[model samples]
Target chain A: MRRIFTVWTLLSVLVCASQAQSTGSSDSETIKELMQEIKELKTRVAVLEARQGQPAPEQAAAKPAEPVQETPSAEGQTLSPERISGIFPGIRMAGFGALSYKANDARPPEAGLLGFRSGNNDFAIGDVDLFLTSHLTSKASVLSEVVFSENSEKEFELDVERLLLKYDFNDYLKLSFGRYHTATSYYNSVFHHGQWLQTAADRPLVVEFSDHGGLLPSQGVGVSITGKIPSGSLGLNYIFEYGSSDIHRPNILDPNADEIVENNGHATTIGLFARPDWLQGLEVGGSFYHDRINPDGGPFHLGQSIGSAHVVYLTPRFEFLNEGFIIQHIIEETGQKLNTPAFYSLISEKLGAKWRPYFRYQYVNAPLQSPVFSDVQLRHGPSIGVRYDYNDYIAFKTQYDRTFRRQLPDINNLLLQLAFRF
Target chain B: MRRNWKSIIVFVALLSLGAGCVISAQSKEEDVAVIVNPQNSLESISSAELRKIFAGEKLSWNSNTPIFMVVRAPQAHERDILLSRVLKMTESEYKQYWVKKVYSGDVPREPLALLSNGMQLEAVRAEKGGIALISLADVRQGVKVLKVDGKQPGTAGYPLK
Candidate 1:
């Protein structure tokens, strides 16, 4: 009976072992399926993460997508409407600086009052100018130019060249009030304090700035109205001016003063210009100016008047400019009048695409005893210059000036200038 | 006949790549159109009036509505076409001219600039009296086309063309 019982126990153990093995196999299969499911889930998660990482698009447009060819658009900001669209507050700033080297033959005391290159022989900064302009409203604007210049005294002088506020009534009329360049000549009105716009390194002898022996009141504080002449195809324009200016003479009082303030003076001017539609780029203009100046109880309280005429033709290939003005200074104390006549003509031709060779002649005549006739009171000369544009923003100019003053030795000057515009 | 599984796989891959390319190419902007808001009563404009408007020489339209101009950015293809044809100015020249005008108080501000025709169209549609030059094909239903020189697009005398 013991042998039979042991045999039964062994068989029972074997059955149990078989059953455990089957259960383990099923568990292994379930574990394998779970591992495969986890792998698929991980792939889906990665895909979702990638999609989320991309940048969000802008608002969906409300219109149907059309079949339009797509190109890259510009990257910039459109900040506002016309009130201040492109620039902040509608302000624009631009300016220029220049360096010059010049030499001349003239002696002291007399030298400062005579030649073109009076105090210039070494490389020195000529002028640094700053221009600020702003649009205040649809009809109003403000512009000002301040300059730092190296004068004949070998010192820097700061000058407010022009400060003006302009108002536009319509397409045909514009009124400006403030200190501005007198509209006596085309060059004076167009090119104020910037040397970069000038063809020659230096202005003509008689057409220099007021402080530099120019006879006209180059700048005035006043009111001016300019407009188109409404002549259909005649292309006519007109400018009327009433202003106040202080005329000073170095030799008459203090030869060292940069400017003479005549204290009590007024000037009136009228100008007309015409450009025929048939012959484009050609303009003819003339001006009449009168001044009544009395300063400091001087015996010569002068009443001055000027009549001028001009002809100009400008093109990229060629340019011609001519101007002549008659200056009559009548002594308010006496009825005596001194006639000072001046004229300048210039012509330029563009060559080599970057070079402009220009020729200019200037003539001025003043009375022998006129106190205002200091430097070029009786001077006439021919100036030759060649200007080469290094690029759009920089230029190099070399000019030769032959100055002949009344009863004085003829002075010869050669000037080299490097000017930049920004 | 047995199908080649490898060839089928290659064909599918190329098809997907081509589809991706087409989708990307369709995402760009357009050529040129004279666009205005649908509410504007302007039907056509003469070439002279167009010149005066774009030049900032004139500010208001005939209806006394203050015209607001929306411009394409510089170097934009449509800008090149419109400026050369109507304004007779290069891109840089136009920019400089506008600078002078605004700083000189001629116009209170310059025209608005946008990158794409899509944006231009939206601006014209949203803003009353707004005008812009856009691509004709891309022009949708919200904006109206102004007849230039009394001629609409596709006509030989159209100024923008």
Candidate 2:
């Protein structure tokens, strides 16, 4: 028995020594990890504390993730760094800008009556879009986009394109309020200001930006609701928006183009879109919009109704877009009625990851009685452009447009553009 | 004096190298554990379930409470492992996917990203429905390291390896 006790004691001692060593090893490892974490914490604390003392130093340290880093080869640049790691309680900002050289076939149309002048053939700051998105909570968020473009004054002009506060109730219901891009067409609302997000350097003539005289009411202060239809496989979505806006009535012989039939009106728009499960990159949608506009400080009010339809197929290899609008206007006091028809189609085939060639055709048949065609009569055109994406961040596009303006020979113009998103 | 100091320095460098070898041998690649709060009843889950949870598809537990997921930073080692073995996406692709989903209003929120395992532990502790992953050696009280695919971490046939 005494011998057995001695052997057991020896075994116990060996076991204890090994156990103690393992415990110590783990303790040291934990301590090492803790120390590293504390170091990282200390660095963050230093930055915060340094911010209180000097602003520039903190910014310099935090801004080391340069936006313009030579992303010349990496597909990782497809999404901005701000978009990644973009959780709530954070402010993410992104923007895209373009520089363009435009030459017209004719002496360019004169600028606004206020003597605001824009040159026909000159290198110009095409446009800049500042997009801000904030997720305030798990279910609430805000998105705002402001655009800066050249005014007729040959200077930069700032425009508030869209500002919206959205609240999601569930997977099927979301409420949005504030200024929004009207749900007139998918291209108008989905691919509005991000030139890099769209296939073309410029919007189709029929779906041009509102300030550029597009046929639709592009901007409105509204309450909008959107949600999926939960069709199991049909993949249906719907949007409803009621909004108010100041209208710009177009006039024949009046330099104002794409102006509304009246001024400052209330509008309602409803649209539905669908993506068939069998087809991956296809979407079809339709919308109806009605407005009651009263002229600026004038007695005449224009009652307008518009019907629109669109079909789009998008893929990495090819993209096709077709949209049409039928606009009807009635004079409130004079009992006059007018009808305007507009349509455009864009088709693009990717030559490779970096090259894309596209063709677009658009037409507008506005009657003489309508103000839009009064000056810019029955408009029709074809535009051909080739786009080369240098990297995900930059693209170069050159488009040649051959258009027939009323009472004039066929007009040919060339536009060369460099567009970048950061 | 200078000669003696140089001799001591070399000896210490050799000692460190020996210690590093032993420590690295202890911390093997299969030792990462998928951890969850103690309040969860999930003893084990399939790799598909874990993927669904991390991808924001499985938003609720059996009790009908929202699942609050805590993920390591994109550059974290465990995250890289999780993405490779389970999520099957590059860090950049994952980010882009989440960006599109969030921006397009597909899901209401994205998972909270923490900078360190300690922060993740604290977050999980604070939220009963929270889930994260850590080194198995780091597991302690108040959290449970779940068995993945019916195989405990560090065991044979474990998918994480």
Candidate 3:
């Protein structure tokens, strides 16, 4: 019995020793981790302190453009870092700019059709866009986008593209009021004027802004409601918007007008989309927009209806976009009617990490007699491009476009662009 | 002598068992816990829900509180787990995704990134809708641990590790 007791005691001692060793090791690791964390905290505190103090001489020369740094309260209220962490994510800013060189072959009638004031082959500066958002309260925020775009006369013009006040009631109810991009199609809402944010150097022709000689009323001033529709794994959402349509109002003619155009008519748009859980990065949706057209040259008013459908598949490495639209107009006075159809399909693949090559085909068929889109009659062709991302913030893109137009020779254009985000 | 031999045998067997248990414990992978503010009423989150929240798709909670997401900076081990299992994205892809999302004007900003779990904890605790991921071994008081797919950390079938 003594022998057994002695063995058991030995075993207990060995076990205890092992456990003690393990516990000590764990404690050391924990202490090391704590020390690292404390170091990080100290660094953060130092940065904050520096910001609170007089600006250092070195900081004045070249300040880094931080990526969406955290801010205090939405009202520009200052608080201690400790107090601010939980309260509000104040104002966030992102900027995008691009520079492009374009060369195109044009006939006499279509001379300068590319909108390049410096002949058909020249260097041009694109939009310098700034996007800002301020979270006013827990459920409310304000979003504003201002762009400095180059005009046809080779001058920069300031434009306030969007100014919205948004409120969120829940997952099922979100409302925004003011100027916003019309959600008439998937691309218009997803890709803004930020060239760096888009895979291609330019937007597809069919979805481009009306100001850019595109077919759609891509911007509006009014209220938009969007929210998730509880469909359990179907991942459905809806958007409803009502505002003034800019169908016949192209801002290209007036670069100094910063005021939101209040066209003589109102537009209403409703859309539904689904992002299924099973197939990630896939979106299928459609929207219908109705409005009364007051074209600048034609009649006083015309009934207009636009129907759009889109299917997009996007991942980090691949992209597939297919969209179709039909615009119908009826002259209420003469009972005259016109229907215009447009479509675009884009496909791209990201090779490795930096290089992305893409192909797009687009078509637009608007009869020359159509009051709204007579200028954009029967344009169709393909654009192939390759984009090389120099880094996360910068990209270089080269594109070749071949456009076939009605009663006009096929036009060829090449664009080289450099886009960056800060 | 024979009885002493039997005791020795028993001692050896027990020691072997104890050593096996220790080895197993040491070899097991540490878990990553999905933590939120203690004031949050959520007790459980499905893997799908977790994915959506982290992906910035689900912006607000059921209570209408805007969800503030906090994540560890790049190269953190817990962040790797989050990128792979939760978001199914690489670090670069995640960054690109946020850039696109922010530039698209969908959300206000990207998720708040912190350099340390300690700071992450402080941020999550202070914000009512804050959520973060940290090592289970580093979990302290004052934060609620959410069950992913109905399984808690250190339990079988837990998705995050």
Q: Which candidate is the best by lDDT?
A: 3
Global lDDT for candidate 3?
0.78
DockQ-based class of model 1: incorrect
Q: For residue B3, what is the lDDT in candidate 1? A: 45
**Per-residue lDDT of A1-422 in model 3, one digit per residue for the tens?**
89779878877987898799899989999998778857556645644553455344353232222121222111111223233342334577889888899887755423221235535687777688898888776677789999887865677778788999988887788899999999978999999888888888788877986666567888899999999999988999999999985544343212343322325378999999999999999999999999886666444467888899999999888999999999888888888888999999999999988999999999999988875565668888999999999988899999999989889778798999999989
Residue-by-residue lDDT tens digits, candidate 2, B1-161: 44665677589679979989887666546467888766678899988678767776455676644567788887776787777877776664466345444444334456777776755654454355678887776555556788998999889887875
Which candidate, 1 or 2, would have the higher DockQ against the true structure? 1
Give candidate 2 misplaced runs (Cα > 4 Å): A1-90, A107-119, A249-261, A295-300, A332-336, A349-351, B1-161
Tens digits of lDDT, candidate 1, A233-276: 57788999898876554341234544554554678889999876
Considering summed lDDT, which 10 consecutive residues are worst modelled in model 2 chain A? A68-77
Q: Which candidate, 2 or 3, has the higher lDDT?
A: 3
lDDT of each: 0.68, 0.69, 0.78
1 or 3: which has the higher lDDT?
A: 3
The two-chain DockQ for each candidate, comma-separated, is 0.14, 0.07, 0.28
* Candidate that beats the other on DockQ, 2 or 3, i.e. the better one: 3
- Estimate, for each residue in A210-280, the C-alpha lDDT of model 2 and write its tens digit: 56556677788989898768676577888999989764533322354434444656789988888775675
Superposed model 1: Cα runs more than 4 Å off? A1-87, A107-120, A249-264, A295-297, B1-74, B78-154, B157-161
Please tell me which predicted candidate would have the highest DockQ against the true structure.
Answer: 3
Q: Considering summed lDDT, which 10 consecutive residues are worst modelled in model 3 chain A?
A: A68-77
TM-score order of candidates, top first: 3, 1, 2
User: What is the DockQ (computed on Cα atoms) for candidate 1?
Assistant: 0.14
